[model samples]
Target: MAEAQREKVIRKIEQHLRKTSRQLIKIDTEEQALQYLSDSFRAKLYCDFVGVVFVEDDLFVPKTWSGNVNEVRDTFPLRVDHCSKQLLEHSLTDKEVGLAVDECQLFSLLKKAGVKTWFTVPIKDELHTFGFCMIGFLSYVPLLEMGKHFDEFGQDVAVAISMTRNREMQLKKIEGIEWITKNLSIDAPFEESIEEITTRAGKGTNAEFACIYLYNDYDNCFIYQPPSYGEMKAPKQVRIEHNYILKEHFPFLEKTGGNQMTIPISMDLKTIGVLHVERKRSGVFMDEDLQILRLLSNHIATILENARLYNNEKENRNRLHFLLEYQQALVKETVKHEGFDGIISMLGELFNESVVLFDRFMRPLTYTMDREEEVLIPQLRAEAEKARRKVNPHIVLTEYSQTFSIWPINSGGDLLGYLAVRMSGNELNDYDQIMIEMARNICSIQFIKQKLVLDATEQAKENFISKLLVENVENHESILQYANLFMWDLYNPHRVALLSITLRENELEGCNLLEQQAKKAVVWDYIKVFAVEKTKEILAAMFKEQYLFIVPAEKGVQEFWPQFYKDIQEAGKRSGIHCDILLGVGGKTDNLHDYYASSEQARQALNIVQSRFKEKGYAFFEELGSYTILHQIDNEKTTDLFLENQLGPLEKYSQGKNMDLIHTLRVYLQNNGNAKSTAEELFIHRSSLLYRLEKIESLLESDLSDAEVRFNLLMAFKLYDMRGKMS
Candidate 1:
């Protein structure tokens, strides 16, 4: 009976070992292996408690338990006493060694739970100790007999756990390599690919955080890329000194009891980026984990470098194609001779932006823009002029959040106009700059071409104006024929207006005749263009220092002349020039032969304005009744003699002194020798006027109450004023 019972126990032990081995073989994880070992021990040995205690640091951690002691699983990992740890270490040094339950904290928990007998066997191989397999029984048990079987079972459980872990690690490595290979392509966005790589890296190594940082060559810093799987506590930018992870790089590791690793993503020994992973310090990383990370890093480096080269080539090809297409479109448009407006519209369409063409005066000559962009045209013109003053093409940012790139249309050394583009939400790349430069060159050519035709037309008009002003015409057929060429109605009643511009001392103070003529030529061109644009039917020409225009004698044209004066003054202020502009209008004439008479009258009126030093602005020839006669006299000595005979004494007295006496005499005569009206007009009391009159009478040796003497003095005052203007 004793031999049969022993054989039954041996068969059951073999059956339990075989059952556990089959379950562990099918198991895919470490937790299943541990749980099966605990269940098998409890059922086969009829033990009340079965627990797996794994050594972690200096504590015994109960990983899994079965039977009645499941309630005490959380009670450990308990801090074992020093002697207990020494006993465990010594017992675990050999495969057959057993630990005394009294000295172990794990068994103490089972002892307190009313376990009567308990034993522990080290779950170890020939080379290393894993942990211990502990068993407890509520009733008395034969420990000497079960101790051998417990040790053998512990060995089997250890092998199962190690094999399961190795298998999982190998699977993880294979998955990592497969993921890297599958995602290696330039079709995906660079950021998306990097994010997938980081996520796979984190999962493969079982890391808490994973991140990839790329090196920015311009900023000279490593910019962190967020992972798709988890959040990172690392900073967004880091300045790395080398291609490895330093212990001091992460202070969170020390505080949170974590470990981190990093590997460089490099090309040709130059590190372009780094891959990082971190985990809580429960277990150290294995060689397999590092191997997976290194593989990912190398693959990431290759992808980055290949993507860069591929994208660069693709970009070059696309840019070249874009430029070629633009050139072809422009050439096709040019063949049609579509003018400046057509070119501006084409640019607007090609760039999908607002475009404006401005003349040298910063006036918007043509534009292709929406309503919102039209509202910004004035601002764009202002900025373009500001940039032109800088003498170069550049970018401008306005307060309204608009960006404009202004390119000067320069012919030779002269800036003819500007071509501006509104770049609202994009940066101008190199290809865009090249296209803009090409457009500017095209615009310059177009401007020169137009200027040539305009110059020829202007020369024809200049010849007609010169002959009409100075030549006497006997036959009206020739004059009519010449006027009809410019679509002018020579039979219409028209007025001749002469506009003369004189720069102030600051502009022409030290300039020679050639420099002054050059400046005047620019001003004359501006005036002629302005006149033609303002009134399409007006015939204008620049002759010497004067601008001549034949405008229809209508109410609208009369109103336009005043505004024209204001416009010229505003232009002078804008151009940083202080100038005096005098415009004189002659009488209307219907006959082409009487046009010369109007020109003479206009010239005479202009001469009157020049005679008055303080006078500027427009004057009509009909308004200057006697001044025209005086200016036409053309005898300076006779006027001087008349002034000497009439008020020569007053003139001598006025020298180096106030002209109060002379002014008093002139006022007295203008009031028809009336004292009260003269005093009122002079804003002086009658007695003070009489006192000046008495002094003037004494100096001039004349009688104040004589009408003939007052008349002579009046003519002298008129000549005197005109003489001052001449001087």
Candidate 2:
């Protein structure tokens, strides 16, 4: 009879084992497995209530249940709190399965569920308690005998749940990989890939939100990328100053009152960015979510790598094509047009962007933009210029995405003005940067080409201006035609001003063509009113280390020569021209004949001013008045003969006695023979000056206080001081 009872027990055990295996095989999902276990436990053990609860992020979620499944999952407020965790520990360690309602933290909740007694067995292996299956009864329940099958049933349940979870995770990872592969294209833009990556991550992990914050070493901060999932938005790029604490700056987290999770997206252990997620509950994120996110992150890194490589290769090919086309365009421009205007037009046409060329000194040489943009573009360029000084990249721009990338045009160590491409977007990808850089190279080459042509043009202008000054105008039409070609209104009423510039002796050591051009540019700026392009009246040309400007005279101008001369002197002082600068002006004229006449007059004036020994300043022919007769002589021979004959006696006395007898005689005669004034004029005492005058009188053999003698002595001193330079 005992053996028959034992065999009955063994058969029941075998049947239970076979049923557990069959249930696990039929149920390929964790939820289904949990549901079958709960129902089986209820039927075999005749329990009134049975349920399976899994711990997901500290919440005892009702995965499946035989009784009250809907209420337990939807509204039943029960979780693995600290007290429940303690109870679970006791159940695992002390092998305690049943707990009276008063002794359990879940007493209130269970009472609400209409259960009088409850028993729990931890569904765990050696690693962790994934959850627990709980059984309860409203009537008398057998507790001692129930322990017999409870342990084995719980162990079987744990293994099934573990396998189901692992299988689900594997399936989830596979779906995630497939989703990423399907959504991402290798040749897609980096921004598109970034947007899709964050979206997929959020979906795969079941996160409420997900966004990327790529760290920029240049800005030393993470730049927030807006999630493309909803209406949320962010700056095109923001330089985050805070560490990982972007709460204050990140606007997306402003209304999100929940636990935040930040997973660093890494490639080869180097963190490139971070993925952000949030949940309303503090511990809603589970380990399974982390696993999913980690897998998604791996795929993201690979997608990023593939996208970059594909885009780089495509960009390289496109850039090579653009470069070849750009060089061909440059060659066309060079052969057709030799000025910067053509090159500027070509750049503007190719890029469909504004092109501004500036000298190294920041002076704009040429520009091509819209009428409305003319003012705005320069200001935008100014800001970009500042950024470039800090971060000298091929493409420079602002965070607001107002303008496109600003490229510093450089070639062979020479920096031309920057080339700014007016892209509609904020970031510069490899293709855009390469295109801009290629444009820069083209600009550099054109700049060099334009400079060479300009130099030759300037030399031709100098020759024409020189010829116009001295050559006889036999054919007024020819001269006028030539002047018209140079945009010079020679027929208009104008005057000639010749300027002779001499550099300071100290700065002469390092002087070269560049230095000369620089100095001339500075001086030209100083005399803007007299520069050819600055004023309709002023037309200047460089010739033989000097400048000859033909200034037009209009009605009521009142002879600009005085102001022009004064400006030249001021310019010398401002330019720090320690050496002397001389300017001579001629009277106004209205025809080529008079213009040539004025040019000759200006040349004579320039010669006289430069040849002076005692007087050095501007000499205007109109202001010269009656002194014009003194400059009409062919050479110094006639003036020399007159001055020698007039002062020969005083000159002989001064040489023999080593005294300035002629000067004494001239001073005495000019001061009306007043000894006191003459002595004062010479800064000497009256008595000593009187003795010199007496000696001068002895040498000259002239009567004292004779008006004719005084007149002749005055004339001689004037010629003597003129030093054969009265012309």
Candidate 3:
């Protein structure tokens, strides 16, 4: 009976071993292997408790256990050195005996839980003890009764479990790594790569969650928030700066005790970021698990680096293409034909951003916006000006997902403006920077070219007008003929206003715009808009050199002359453009052929006024003694005497360097007896200019307030200017 019973036990043990072997082979992950050995085979194997304990560097840890596992796990510390030192020491020194505890203590503890006998077998690989497989017997069985057969059977099962678990772990690791490498080689986007890695890692390791953190060098931070989980509430950034993280709040590092594991992702001795995982069960990870995680970390780092490089290369290629297009457009002068708006739009499309072009004064000349303009124009102007003044090559501003990079456009050693490009959610990489530089260069060249063209055209027009004036064909008949020709030739508006010089001597023949000072003043005043309304009319007519016109009045000649004179005087005073005016009145005549006769009469009136008022002041045709006398002074003798008398004091004043007389005369004329404005112009105290004016009044020995005396002094100054020009 005893022998038959023993055979039955042997057959059952064989069946149990066969089933364990089959389950271990089918298991795909470490967690499955652990669960199979602990839960499915425990009771059938005559074990009160089944536990798999992994050993590393003489330390033992209970990875998974059955038979009131929760209670045991909660009661004991997970630390191998402190919790399982006795078992580890016994397993290391004595393989044959295995590790044993006092029957009283072990059996009593088991008996309380409906278990009476206990046995533990050391799990081994190549003669080294990695862990132990433990089983508890429900009925008390004497050691002698179990004998060598029972002990050997237990050892075989433990060894098989350990070997199978290790083999599967290594295979899963290789498969996981291979999958990541294959996916990354295709140059996947960051999000796609991350998703694939995390899913594979989670499934292979039996983890509940997986995450990757990437290093950001610019912000000096780490980004760990994953899209699958939405934005993580945990802080995504860890600043390397001091006082960032307190020691008390440091994250737990033990892999087995906590639900989390953090492994440094490294390549070539450099740590890039961290890979973190969390398991649902407590005390689940072992040393082998950590080894697998470290391997996975290496694979992740390689894949991340490759993805980054691929993105960089792609960006560089796109930027190069954009630069080529920009250069081509600029070289072909397409930018000029398209205008500022077109250029800005092209820039925006090339960079996938909104672009704005500013003028030399930092005013926005053209802008392309992808969205509505929410920011104030003044704010944009202010920011652009600040960037321009600093000459910053790139100024980056981040607000939400948008980033603005402002680049200065420099032309001919002068800052012309800026190019502002707005990028959404991404930083400006090296390729973007290179493209911006190319754009800046192109813009600078185009701007300079346009300015040069404009300047040359203006110069040529001035030269043409100067030639006509110097030929002494600027009278009414000749000017009208030129005006008619200009009206037919030009497309813009045209108007002709006669500007006659009221000389204080018989009229000078060679007086025209050809004189260098007058020509220079005309050009300067044209640029300064000194007489913008008048200049615009002339530019519309001829688009060239300055001119003087003489027009005959048809009616109201008496009333028109004074008003016209006042308008010219005020315009000159307002703009600081110094020029004398003379009006020519003639009887109404519709015949264009009679213009020459009217012009001659006007010249005769101008000559008479120039002689009589050469030292007194300018005179009108109505103020002249008679038309006969005015016509008589067109002789050379009258002009010679007028010049000598009017220019005598100026000659003496110039030779003696007596600015007192010149200043007194200038103030006397400017003040027009007000006394205040003249003093301000001379930068002297008002009382001083007044005293000097009084001295001039005494020297002249005339009532300065008298219209005749004042007129004489003013004419003398005018004659002095005319005589100096002649000399």
Per-residue alpha-carbon lDDT of candidate 3 for residues 464-518, written as tens digits (9 for 90 to 100): 4444333243445444555564452222221123234432222234556355345
The best candidate by lDDT is: 1
Candidate rank order under TM-score: 1, 2, 3
Q: Highest TM-score: give the candidate number.
A: 1
The per-residue C-alpha lDDT of model 1 at residue 474 equals 62
Error of 1 at 365 (Å): 2.6
Q: Candidate 2, residue 491: CA error in Å?
A: 11
Clashing pairs in 2: 537-552
Instruction: Give a tens-digit lDDT track for model 2, residues 1-727.
Output: 9768767766775587568756785666787887777787788767777877766655666677676534434554355663356434323322242454445446546666666566776776666676777777766553443443556656666777778888899988888888887888887667788788777766665666677777788787777766454334435465666555555544333232235555666788786776666542334556677777678677777777677678778878886887788868777876776556777777788767777766543455677888876665656556654565656433333443455555676766655566555666567776656667666766777777766776687777776665566546565565666677777666678887777776666766678978776776566545543333335646666766667777766623345655556666676565444556677777788666676677767766666576542154677665554346555556677777777666776666667575687667766776888888889998888888978877766766777678787776666555554353323
Question: Candidate 2 has what TM-score?
Answer: 0.54
| Candidate 1, 165-213: lDDT as tens digits | 7787777667767877786678778778878888787877678778888
Better model by TM-score: candidate 1 vs candidate 3:
1
TM-score to true structure, per model: 0.58, 0.54, 0.51
Residue 487 miss distance in model 3 (angstroms): 4.0
Off by over 4 Å in 1: 1-284, 287-321, 324-338, 371-415, 418-420, 425-441, 474-482, 502-532, 554-580, 590-592, 609-616, 628-665, 674-705, 716-727
* Clashing residue pair totals per candidate (backbone < 3 A): 1, 1, 5
For candidate 1, which ten residues in a row score worst on lDDT? 88-97
